[model samples]
Structure formats: C-alpha cells, structure tokens
Target chain A: MTLNRVMTVDDDRFDQLAYRRILKKTNAKIDLLPFQYATEALEYLKSPTRRPVDVILLDINMPRMDGFEFLEAAKTELENQIVIMVTTSMDPQDRSRAETFAPVRGYFSKPLTTDDISVIDRLVAQQ
Target chain B: MIDHDSNSRAHAPRSFAQSYATALATYVRDGNEENLSRAYDCARQALQSSISIGQLGELHFQAAQMLCSGSPSPSPETKRTEEFYLEAISVYDMALRGYGESVAQLTAEVLERKRAEQELRDVTYELARQRDSLDQKVKARTRELQAGLERSERLNSQLQQANQEQAQFTYAISHDLKSPINTIAMLLDIISVDHQEHLDSECLELIDAAQATASRMSRMITGILQYARLVGQEAEFETVSLDKLCRDVRDDLRQEITDGKAEIDISPLPDVRGMPSQLRSLLQNLLSNAIKFRDPGRPCRIAVSAAPKPRNCAAEITVSDTGIGIPEAYRTRIFSLFQRLHTYDEYSGSGIGLTLCQRIAGYHAGDIQVVSNEQGGSSFIVRLWINERERDNDTQSGDDG
Candidate 1:
C-alpha cells in the first residue's frame, strides 16, 4: 500500500525541514503538507476542499492552539486519519496524555531517527 | 505521784506492787543480792493488799525474769542462788494464767498493724500506675502535635514552589520560542549569501544584518529564560569548590580571554553548598563581563578571591577586574533586568549578565553587590551561605522573583 498524504503541525521551521528531509530520504510516494501553527493545520482540516490526509505528525509545543488543543478542535473531523504526536518535551506525562486521545496512535521524541522512520514506514504499509 | 492519786485509793494495791517490781529490777540490774532480798520482802507485803491476779502475775513475772537474767558480775553456784532461781520459777508458773489474756491482746494489735501496712502498699502501687499512664498520654499528645506541625510546614513550602513554577512557565514559554526564530533567520541569510552571484550585494548586506540581529536576539532570549528559570528550578545542592568553579569558567571563555589578552588569577576558595550549574553561571557572567568591558589599552587582569562573611558565616566571593569600572550611580541599576549602562556597540552583551548573576546569588540564599575597587576597577562580590538551617531562615526573607 502506498502512503498518499502526511501533514505536520509544528512551530519550528527547522524541525519541519528535518522531518521532510527524513521522509524524502525514504523515497516514499507521500505528499507533504506543513503547517507553521497548529491552528492553521486545524483550519486546513476543516476546509471543504482540503486533501484527505492519511497521517498527521503533531507537535506539542506551538505558538497558538497547541497540538492537544488542535486535536480537541478537530477530533471529530480527524476520525479517518492516524495521528502521531511529535515533541521535544522530555516529560513522559505528555506522551501518556496524548495516547488517551483515540486518534493518536504513537509518540516520538525530537530529531526522529532512522528506526523511527522505519517504524512509521511499517505502520503505513500495514494500513 | 502519791498526792495525785490520793483520791483514787482503790488503785493503791496495784501501784504499790508496781513500785516493788521496779525496786526488784533495779537491785537485779546493780547485782545487789541484799537489796534484791529486801525487794522480795516488799513484794510479799504488797501481795497482802488486794491487787488483781493479772497485776500480781505481771509484777512477779518481771521480778523472776530479772533474777534469771545473768548479771554483770557472775553469780557463784551457791545454795542462796539456787533458792532465788527456785522461787523465781514458782512465781513464773503462777503468772502464766494471767499472762494468757495479755498475750491475746498483743496478737490482735500486731494483726491490725499488718493490715494497715498492706493497704498503704496497694494505694502506693495504684498511684504509681496512674502516673505512668498520664506520662504516656502526654508523650502521645506531643508526638501528634509535632507531626501536624511538620505536615503544615511541608504544605507551605510546596505552595510557594508551585507559585514560583507558574511564573517561570509563563516567562519560559515566550522566551524559549525565540531560538527557532533565530535559526530560521540564519537559514534565510545562508540561502541568500550562497547565491550572492545571482543576487545584488545590497540585498546580501541586508540579509547579513538581519542574521546578526537574530543571533543577538537569540542570545538575549536565552538569558531571559535562564533568569526566569532560576526561580522554579530545583537544582540539586552540592558542595561546590569555588576555586574549581573559577577554573572551569576560565576554560569555557578561553577564546574570549585569548582574543582580549585577559589574565584570570583565582585564589584559594572555600567550599560552599549551592547548585553547581547556577554557581558556574554566576561566575561565568561576572568573568565574561570583566573581559568584555576591559580597557583596550592594557592587558585585562581579573582576580577571583574568597573570604568568610563574619555575620552569617557565608563565603564571600569577589571577582575584581582591572578594567573600566562601573560608575557608582549605575551600580544598583545594573543588577536589574535589561538595565544596561553601555549600548550594545560599546559593550556587547544581552544586558542580563548581572541580572542572571544576582538571580543565581539569590537562589543560593545570597546576594550580589558591586563596588569600585582600589585598583580603579569593578569588584563584583557574591556571598553564599554554608549548607545549614540558617540558610532557610535567610532565604525566606528575600524574594526569589
């Protein structure tokens, strides 16, 4: 199965570039949609003409409408998509709390390694 | 005695017998055989009067017991001595019947005294048990009170810590986000400069200026976050060797020192209790400031020394620099956040170096003060309390914020 679309919600431009680079290295046929703010990502999801996203990489730390707030705002609309929380926070409580949301499937720390990318690849193949 | 009893003449016989018995005892005690015989004669005369059998028996019994008892002088085994013993035995036999009644009375008195003694012992035992129970109750009450006091103290400190953490979280949220903004601005500069041949020099210069401002803002933001975090961070306290801390700070700023031709002289320093990171940052800020504000004409000379504060037994660390000294009027203002005596071009800094140092000093329950040195330079003095209970008392008086 080929992955069609992936969206990233993050405030940091550097992290957004790094995540895209990691995915590009895998040569996966996935369209990347990046949002500099969680609110923008939520708005994009709410828009009528938006592409169907297969998976979302959500960041916990953001300027306005944090990743959790975004999830709360778009939980009903995100029923068909898988969400993977991405954060630089070392607090384990953040991951545990994110997992309680039905749409969230996994949590990964910052600077996603090759193994993390492989795990994501396998998970996408299963879907 | 006869005059007092003249009206009680019925008691005459008994009194006379008692007097004869006394005379017989006196003669026997003195070992006077002739007087003893005369006393026996007086007794026989008294017996002729009508004394009671009990009294007669008591009188004879005493005279007999005294005769039989050995005298001070040995009595020779003579016929007269044998006769005296015989007479004493005969009188003793007659007195036994009367003595039986007196024996019963004496036995009854002894039993009553024993019962009274047993009752006294039981009462004493009960009083002792009650005292022990009361003592236990008092001790239990004291333990409960102590536990309650400790719990309240713990809760109070926890509330204070929560308040501090809330304030820090707000400041860190805004300040920490600047790091990414700086990175993005630098990346923009790199992209523009790498393709300078395709772009105009005027545009490239503008990008460079933007990059420089972003980097400086990044440093300032970091400083702001660091200052704010000092309130909430529960950094572990350990024994810090001030001399070693100075050496480490010197190593970290080696490049700056070489660029400025600065010399750092650290004297023997005392060990104190404080967070290692905070103490290191405090020294780093002061040292970097000294180097940055150095007089360009001469080599920069910095001396780090320590002495004990007499009032609180805390170590007083003094970092003195032979550079442009701070003016007396601006000394207090320099320690405040973002308060700068010089412009960014004049002396490069985030303008929070002294503020960070002051915050770190406060974290250690200490204070930082600046004074003009005799060598015409600035001396930054930081006092740190030793690890002890007095630190808590001293820390409570000052506001960490």
Candidate 2:
C-alpha cells in the first residue's frame, strides 16, 4: 500500500496553514492539497481524479457543509481514504458523533502539534 | 238531647284543635316540608289524648285540600317538595277512611288515594337516595381537582431546580475550558519563536492573529461564566454609603480617568441597604461607561449625585457624564448581554459590563436606566427603595443564582 497524495478540508485559513507547516516539517515528501469548503472537497473526491487522496484532515465546524455531512456524502462517493477529524470544539457529543463514521481514523483538537503529525503518519502507514 | 249536650261539653276546650289548624295553615302558606311534618305531629298528639277520629279526619281533610291547591309543580325534585307531596297523600287517605260506611261513595275514593300515595312514596324515596349520592360525587371530584393542582405546582418547582443545576454545570465547563485556550495561545507563541528562521513575516503574523483570537475567546467565555454565576449567588445585604462607593469606583478607574482627562464630582448620597460588592460593581460599570464614551473634543466631566425622590418613595442616584449620548432606541437593548452599540475598534469591551450592572441592580431590588441629559451627555439613573423590606421581589435564592 503505497500512499502519496494528502488533502485537508477546513474553513479556517490559519488552521490550514498550520497543517501545511506541520506536514512539511514532519514529512516533507508527502503531497498536500487544501480546500476551504467541505462541499468543494467532496466534489473533488467524486470527480475522476488522476490520483486519489490517501488521507483527509477534516474540520467539524464550518459554514454550509460541515465535517459530518462531508463524511456521509464521501462514504459512498470515494474509495479507501483515511479521515482524521480536526476540530476546536470541546464538546464530548461531537467526538461521539464523529466516531460514528467508519472512514474516520482519528480525532484531534486545534493547534495540532508535530507529535500529532507523527501519530497520523503511523496511521497512514497502516493503510 | 243528652248526647248532643255531652258532645258540646267535650268540644268546649278546643285549644289542641286550634293549635293544629294554625300549624296546618302555616305549612300550606309557606310550602315548607318541616312545617307540614310539625302539623302532622300535632294531629297525632291530639289523637293520642282521646280526640275523636271523626274530628281528626275533618281537620286533616281541610289541610289536604289546602296543600293540594298550593302544590306548585307535579314532579317533586327537592327533598322538601317530596315530603310535602307524601304528607298530603297521607292526610287525604286518613280523611277517606274516616268517612266509613256512612258515605258509601268514599270507599272508591279511599282505594284510589291509597294507590296514588304508594306510588308517590316510592318516587320520593328514589329521588332522595339519588340526591345523597350526587352530593358525595361532587365532593370526590373537588378533592381530585385540588390534588391535581398541588401536583403540578410541585413539578414546576422541581423543573426550576433542574434548570438551575444545568446552568451551574455549563458555567463550570466554560470556566474550566479557559485554561486550555490560554495554553493554545502560549504554544502558538512558542512555535513562532522556535520556527523564526524557517518562517516568513506572513506566517508570524498569522500565528500572532490566531493567538489574539484565542485570547479574545477566553475573555468572552469568562464574561459568560460571570453572568451565569450571578443568577444563583447569595450575598449578604448591608447599609452601604453611595458617596464612599463612588469614591472607591473612581479609585479603581483612576488610570482611565487620568488618560481621558476626566473629573468626577460626588454629592452627598443617601445610605442604601444592599450587597456591598454588588452595589460597587453597579457603580463601577456606570462610572466606567461615563469615562469610556467621553467626547474627544473636551475633557470628561462627570458628576455623581443622589437625591431623595419626591414623597420619600425611592432614592435616585444619577451618574451624569459629558459623553456622546446613546440613541433613545438603543437605550433599552443596551442592558442585554452581548449587545454592543459600537465596534471593538471604537470601544474595547466584552459588552457584559452594563448587563452585569442590570443584574446587580435587580438583585438589590433596584433598576438602572439611561436618559439623555439636557446639559449634554447621558445620565444613568439607578432607583433604589430606602426600605429593604420592599426589596423582597428582587431577592435572589441560592438555587436561582
């Protein structure tokens, strides 16, 4: 299982930037693609892309299409892509709701550190 | 002639017969069953004392004729009406029996009267029994309604207690989450320093912006927790001097006053009974607003005055300032939580200061309002009743805070 492309769906630009910095610092060789809107990201996944994304970093709180809605739509549309939920919400109910999706591999709070990237790296390697 | 003379001798004393006639007349006139029953008792006594059946029957026959004529309706619904009908039947039956064989036609009349009396007695008995049962049912229904009302009241109080507990839980959660936000801000600062060589100016700015947002969020959360804590707080009430309170608040805002070039004048104020800390906050909020919303053209001039309102009804403490007056439309809404009239750039506030002031005033059984001053700026008046006993309506319970 050789993985290459990586994708991130988050509304916050800073958070997306943080992920870019963390991913570059932890594993620079991995390919990264970022989307500000969940709907656009889902559309991209549904399209006949040349390379399928191996991992997706999804934020739960967003404008129109939230993280949960994206996961539900992406489940039937996309092939095997590991989802790692990224959110600033401290709500316990949100964690339980996120876990309901089969494709979700992990969950982490905002300001994701380099240590968190290592854990994600290991999870991606398992795929 | 001798037998006739002896009859006249017996009729010479007519006292019992006269008394019985009078009672029968009263019963017929009033239509009261009790009176009719009394008439019957009188007749029975006269008979027991050797009054002739012929004489007793004649008196009863007259009473029966008067009662039958006085009968208002046929279907006796009331217990008294039933009694009257039964008594009338009994009197007529006895009168017919008195006629004996001397009046042969009365034998048919006696049989007819006896049959009618039996029918009426059965109907009256049934009606009386039904009335008694209905009375019992009404009493049972009343008891059921009273019990239901009490149960709902008890449930309502329980619901109120549950709501208060839920509020406290939410406040505690917000209070606890503040530390994590601070930690995140601190971590971002550290990351900026550690990656300075690798990071560009744009990246450093983004990190700083993120840290600022985190700090702002923490402040907002703290404001919410403060508001929630006020709902169920129990503070000891004391007689506080407003002049001293204003002085203390001025001291707290000394730096702001100096920066804004503001002058605060305090008048002789009335002593009020309330929670000292809450009253101080109320004064501090109003005073801070007076300083914050000052006109840039001139130095801020604020006067704190208190006067006993006419008729000794309530004491009014006014905090008048030389600041831009608030529009009348926004005056009422300003007391609401998170309602800000100006942007964060123009006014630096969590928008919870005035809200807290309103809550504190409510706790002390007072009201705070802003009105335009004729001399320019705004006057925020706080009306407080002198008598603490009248403050019962605004008193806070531990569960409610």
Candidate 3:
C-alpha cells in the first residue's frame, strides 16, 4: 500500500493501550500501529511488509533498549520517517537534545488523548 | 567609744590669738637666740622706743637678777609676762600640728571623690556603646525580614499559577475524553438490546468488558470535571446545613465505602457558613480518601466532628479516619496536584482529589490540614472564617483572569 503510516513504541502495556485507544480516533489519511518492543517493531518496519511510516511516537523509558538507543540504531535505516518523542518528563535539556534530530515532528506528555491529534496532523501536513 | 588619749594624740585644736601673741613675745625674750634672732632684730627698735635707753638697761639687769633667783618674780610684773609667754608658745605648737593634719585630710577626700567620678564616667560610656550596638542590630534584622518577605511573595505567585494550571488540566481531560466514552456506551447498549439471540456467550462477555471499561472511564472523566469546576468557579457563601449536607454526601458515597470495606461515623455537624457543594465535596474527598488508602489491618472508620473553635471565636470541623493514614512527610505534598502517596495499582483514581479539597477550602476562607504518623490513621482539621468568605472567593476567582 502507498498510504503513509504512524506507529508508537513503548515498554508499558498501559501506555500501549492508551496510545491505541487514542490513535484510533484520528481522522488522518494514514495507517497507524503501536508496539511494546523496540527491536521487534524495528525489525517488522524494516521488513517489506510495513512501508513508509509517516510519523513515529517513541517513548523514552524502556527495559534495555530505550527510545534514544532506538533512534540511534534506526536513524540510518528509517532516516526517512518523522520521529516524535513523547514522554511524561518536562525536562528542558531532553527536549533540546530531541530537537537535534531534524526529522523530529513533535513532543508530548502522558495520558495521550485526542487532544494530541491536531498537533500531529498539522506537523504531518507541513512535512 | 573612741579613746580620748588616742584622739588627743592624733590631732589638737588651733588657737589663733594665742599663737600671734606667743610669736611676738618670744621674739622679744629670745633676742640673743639664733632661731628667733630675725624676729628679735625686728622687735629691738620697738622695745627700745617703749623704754628709755637708761631704763631699758636697768630693767634688763633687774629682770636677769629676778629670773636667776627663781623667787617667782623677775619682778612680779616680769613673772606674769614670762608665764603668759610660756602658755602661748604651747598653744602655737598645737595649732601648727592641727592645721597640717586638716590640710592632709581634705586633700585625701578630694582625690577619692575624683576617682569615683572617673569610674562612673567609664561605666556610662560602656552602657551607651551597648545601647547603640543593640539598636543597629534591630534595624538590620528588620531589613532582612523585609527582604525575605519579598522573596516569599514571588514564590507564592508562582505556586498560584501552578495551581491554576492543574485546574486547567482537569478541564482539558474532561473535554477531550467525554465523547469517546458516550459513543462506546451507546454502541454497547444498542448491540445488547437489539441482537441478544444472535450474539454468542464469549462475544457477549467481550462486549460486557468493553462496556464496563467505558463506564469506568466515564466516571473518571466526570470526577476530573467536578474537580476542575470546584477550582474554576468562585465559591458561593451561604448558610450550610452541615448535618444534612454530610448525610447526603455519605449517602452518595455509601456504595463506594461498602465496596472498600469501610464505615463512616458522622458526629454532630455544626451549621457553618460556606459553599454547600464544595464543602460537601471537601468532606466527601476526605472520607473517600479514608476508603481509597485503606490498610490491611483495619476496616476504615471515618470520624467526623465539629466543636467550638479555640478562643470561642471560630468553628472547627475535624475528620479522622482509621485507614492507612498519610505519612508524616506527605502531609504537605498530599495537598499538591497529582501528588500520589500510593501507587496507581494500589489506588484506582486520579491523584488530584485532596488538591481539589484544599482549593475548595481556600476558596471558602477556610484551611484544611492533615496530621498523621507513618502507619497510624490521619486526622484532618478544617477551620472556617465566615466573615472573610466573600473576600476569599474574590481572591480565588481573581487568579483565573
């Protein structure tokens, strides 16, 4: 399929549940998937089955491989995709570092809801 | 009782007239002696003038003959003069010694008084120095307090802004989540009513779980909305029927209390002036907290009471619970937004309940605080001010704009 896709990667089961429930409400013309494991999700996206994810929702805290590590590894392979780091932390230094990735589209907080859709949609349009 | 002999030896009285006569006469009598020769020379001319030269010579010879005879008359006239001269000489010697002693004593007294004056002057100077130093310290301390007050004011304004943001977060949650819950609820109701026979048991069970989750989400959203509303609107001050109001609140929360294995005891409630709904929610939040943070050892018992405020001035309402009380360190933090002493799995609600209660109490010109140990249950006290209620409402509402 040529249609663009959006996906989320987080270690938390509750975060995945909340992300799915929220992302399903989007009226955007793109496919979306959520994953709890970074490597498995990365492998699947790298395989021919999933193509051209338009937006990525990456969470910071995970078991072994965190969002920063995932970004480092997948930067070359999926350099084409727009990455967004969503977390509960309001730390300014982290935000600045995330901004170093030129393709980063947005950063948001926890309890993700329909409120976040407009910002993401705007970002997707501009890109 | 001084000894007279000792006193006499120490000093003697002065005789001025006797001392003058003795000095003149001794000069006349001792003209030949070296000690009084100067006086004798000065008197010789006067003596020669008083007697003719031949008579002076004859009187001298006769006086010398009478003085050697020891016959009690140098001539009787010379005898009287010689005896008076002897008495005068003794008086002169006594007067000289007395005058010397008086001069020495007066000099000593003057020096002693001067020394005492100098010591008093030094003590006065020291006291002045101490007073000046104390005055300067007091002024410096006052300035420091004023500066500290300004800094605290800045922090207070920042805290007020944070509180407003927390309230706004609630509004956002409500506005964002309500429609989804309603849609899910409606969809489930439609399916259950229309397609009862067509649906299998497992499918029915899945749909039931979905509906229940949706319901729970709806309740949580409503709770968040109520919390936001309590903080957003200005408080309304009126006569609050404490007894009836609490009863209604208890009735509303009875099911939740029972579900959590709790008992609520309402002591006699005093009629107070406050916003009835917000105050009811405040009491409800406290009681609900008692249920939410229950201990393994204890079935929760919430005790509510009211008594005359100290100094017979205000009214106080107390709510004590036999649940897992707040830790001593969390007493201040529990009033903060999203401050959860316990984890999410242990308690099933948003962490802003007590924060809402605090905001409501603040709006009513009242304050609420908690006192508890590590494992012991907590006692919460609410102090109210009826006269300041309108002013407090104005202040709470003023922050929004």
Candidate 4:
C-alpha cells in the first residue's frame, strides 16, 4: 500500500496518544502509525511490503530499540525520509546525536498539541 | 679595651720562653697538662737559677768560717780558689733571680691565655648551633613556599578549565539553541501570517499549537540566559540598595502579578552589596514564580523579608510563597537547570528560574537555602557576605561541640 504519512514510534501508550492527537489537525494527508513496542515498530519499518514514509516521529526514550536504534537501522535506506523526533527529553546530547541523521527534521518535547505538528508542514514542504 | 682595663702591661707579647712557661702554668692550673712537658722550658730555667743561688750562699759561708779560724799561713792557691768560688756563686744567684721573675710573669700570662681559650671555644660552639638552626629554618621556609606555589598552580589550572567549560557550555547553548527556536517561530509566523483566516478549523488548531510551542521555547531560552548570567558568566558587580531593588523588581513584575489573584507582602529589604540588574532579575523571577505557581482555588500570598547579621555586615533574604508547595522529593531537584516538577499544562515555568537564583547567590559569595514541607509552601533563603570573622563566630555558636 502506498503510504503518505508520518510514523510515530514510541513505547509509551500515553505518549502515542498525545502525538496522535497533536497530528490530527495537520492539513497534510498523513497517517500516524504508533508503535507501543520497539520491536514491532522496527519490524514494520523493515518489512518490504510497507511503503516508505514521508516523515517519522521517533521518541528518544523507549524500551528495546530506541529512536537512536531506529535511526541506525534506517540509516542510509531511509535517507530520503524525514524523521522528526518527538519526546519529553530535553537533553542536549540527544539533540546532537539526532543531528547525525541528515533527514532528522525537528525535536519536540511532550504535551504536544496541534501547533507542534506544524513541523509536519515544514518538513513536507522541505521534501 | 685599653681605656677600660687600665693595664697596658697585661697585653705585652711573650718571648718564646715566656710563652712556654705561661702555657705550662695554665695547663697545670686547669688540670689539663697533657702537653706541659713540651711547654715548660721557661719554668725549668727559673728553677736552675734558684739552684745556682743556693750554691753561691754555701760558698760564702764556708769562706767566712775559714777566715774566722785565722789560719796564718794561707796559701795563694787556696785564696785564688776561694775567689773563683765566690764569682761562680754570684753568677748563679743572678741566674736564679731572673728565672724567678720570668716564671712569675709566665704564670700570670698563662691565666690570661686560659680565659681567652675558654671564651673562643664558647663562641665557636654557639655559632655552630645558631648556624644549624638557621639552616633548618631556611629549608622549612623554602619547602613551605614550594608547597604554596604548587597549590597556586593547581588552583589556577582548575580555574582555567572551569572557565573554558563555562564558555563552551554557554556557546553550545547559544549556538544550537536559536536555530530550533527560530525555526519553530518562523514556521508559526509563516502559517499565522500567510494562512490564518483562510484556514479551516483544523488548520487553525495547528496555528494555536505552534504559537504555544514557540512561546514556551522563547521562555526557555530566556531562562537559560538568566541561568548563565547568574552562574558568574556575567561580568562586573555594582552596589545595589535593598529597598529600592525589591520595589523595582516588584514593579517589573507588575504585569505578571496583575492577574490580581496573588497577595504579595514585601517588607523593607536591607541592602548590603551586589549587582543591581542581576539582583533585580533574581527578585523579579522569584516574585513572579510565587504568583505563577499558586494554588488555583486559593489566593496566592507571598512574603519577602531580609535578615541582617550585625550592622549590615551580611544579610540573608528570604522569599516565601503560600502556594501549592513543592513535595519533599522535588526540593533538591528544583535547582537543577530545566528540571520541572509540574507539567507545562498545570504550571508554566522554564524550570531554570530557581537554578539561576542559586547561581546568582553563589556568584556574590553567598548561598541559598530551601525549606518546605508537602502541605506548606517553599521558602528560599539567600545569604551573602560570608567573611572570615563571621565564620569564626559561626564556629563559636555555643553548641557544646
């Protein structure tokens, strides 16, 4: 199936809900695939049957494989795809680390509301 | 010495014989005649002279006895022999008189020599002892100086490293901080300015969300800047009046507290010493924080007071708020940069306000103390001007220990 949406990979259910709620008002035709578990998210992203995403909202703090791990797996293959990190963490080192991914767009902290997803408009426009 | 002693004769130089006799007499008197035999030539000569005098006396007496016997036919040869004996006795008596005089003089000289030797030995021993003590003291002083130099070097390097790290931290914060904020802000500006009225309800929601995020970001950047300034990254300090400082700060926060829900009580604060702009900022942040974090149902009451230590030498100012007080676990955590106890939805804080306040106190050679309970509110005590004498008094506070 052709997918023209952003995937939010987070291990916490509340965070997924929050990110999904924030993404609802965006004018972009985007679908949000929230993975509460890391392994499942990685499996879905690696599957050949799934179409590539326009952007990925990866949370920094997670169980199993974190956003960093997901970024590593999708390294060169997801070069064209935009990755906007979404998490409650404000650590400087995490932001610096995310810089390694050329496609990594913006970092957003939690309690994300409709306004925070405008980065979607920005990122899609850049692509 | 010549004018005081009145005895110029005592200093006459001794002949070899006189010197020998004086040394022997001195050694004997002191009971240390270990080399007396080698040094007694003059004393032996004096004894020989005395023996010669006794021989002369015996000869004279014998001649007189012969004359008294009146031997009529005295031979010319016997007369000649008697004359010779008399001459020999006269010469021997003269030699003995000279020896006696010489020995007496030598003995007197020996006593003087003994005193001189005793004084020389005492002075030498004393000098050696003083030299040894002086050497030890110099060594100890040099070692102490070296230790002091090393400590200074270590302190200097540590200070340099700390400064470098501070600069880097500020730079990193400044350099990377703006890009994200500007990007977010630019995005918001573009959407709100370009596509606001034309936007549907859903699109309008995006604009609102972006504005909130941008506003929150701007507040955080301001908070971090305040934190840096408070952490001694800012330069120079000017004297600030306490009463005026508090009033100015209160005035500055007028817009913040004008929500009119807060009851702020500020007594006259005593000024000691500090930077006004920074202090005002500190007061403004603290006052505003009190108003911002109050209980929703109850009206917020804030009290600001200062405690001075003896004639305005040092002061401790406290800011207390009757708000939903911090939990016991969160007290220590509140001073860390960007550490927030409450979520943004409940309370709006950049989380760097108290952290900056503490850093400011430290920069002014002061400290901040926090006290609070779960039910009650938090009171922050800031102390300044901690000098040596005050520390001594603190140590002597009658605690039995």
DockQ for every model comes to 0.01, 0.04, 0.04, 0.04
Please write out the lDDT profile of model 1 over residues A39-105, one tens digit for every residue.
Answer: 7888888898898877899988664356788888998888867888889888888888898898888
* Top candidate, metric lDDT: 2
- What CA RMSD would candidate 2 show? 19.2
Question: For the second chain of model 3, what is the TM-score against the true structure's chain B?
Answer: 0.48
The digit string of per-residue lDDT tens for model 4 on A44-63 reads: 86788887776777877654
lDDT of 1 by residue, B1-401 (tens): 44555555677765664555555555545545675565455544554564554665666566555565664434542334444434544444445555676788778878888888888888898899899889999999999999999999999999898869775775767475786876778787777867878878877766775676677677877787777777667768999888898898899999999998999999988888889889999999999999998988777999999874445546888999989998876788788766565534355567678888888887787888999898789999887763455565755433322
Q: Residue B106 of candidate 1: its Cα lDDT?
A: 78
Pairs in clash, predicted candidate 4:
A115-B209, A115-B210, B49-B96
Model 1 lDDT on a 0 to 1 scale: 0.75
DockQ of 3: 0.04
Cα deviation at B163, candidate 1, in Å, is 3.5
Chain A only: give the TM-score of model 1.
0.92
Every candidate's lDDT: 0.75, 0.76, 0.68, 0.67
TM-score of chain A of each: 0.92, 0.92, 0.84, 0.85
Interface RMSD of 4: 8.6
Q: For candidate 2, what is the interface RMSD?
A: 9.6
Off by over 4 Å in 2: A1-127, B1-145, B188-208, B310-314, B386-401
Task: Estimate, for each residue in B1-401, the C-alpha lDDT of model 3 and write its tens digit.
Answer: 12333444322111222222344345445543452433233234323234333443344344344444555533554654444344433443454577688888888888888888888888898889889889889989999999899989989998878878888887887978999889989999889878989999987876886776677678678878987777677656899888888888889998988798778888878887788888888888877877777776867777888874432215578888777776565578778765555423245555567888888877766678898734388888877773353444544432221
| A66: Cα error in model 2, Å | 23
Residue B250, candidate 1: Cα error in Å is 0.8
Q: How large an RMSD does model 1 have?
A: 18.2
Misplaced by over 4 Å in model 3 are A1-13, A16-127, B1-177, B188-213, B311-313, B342-344, B373-375, B386-401
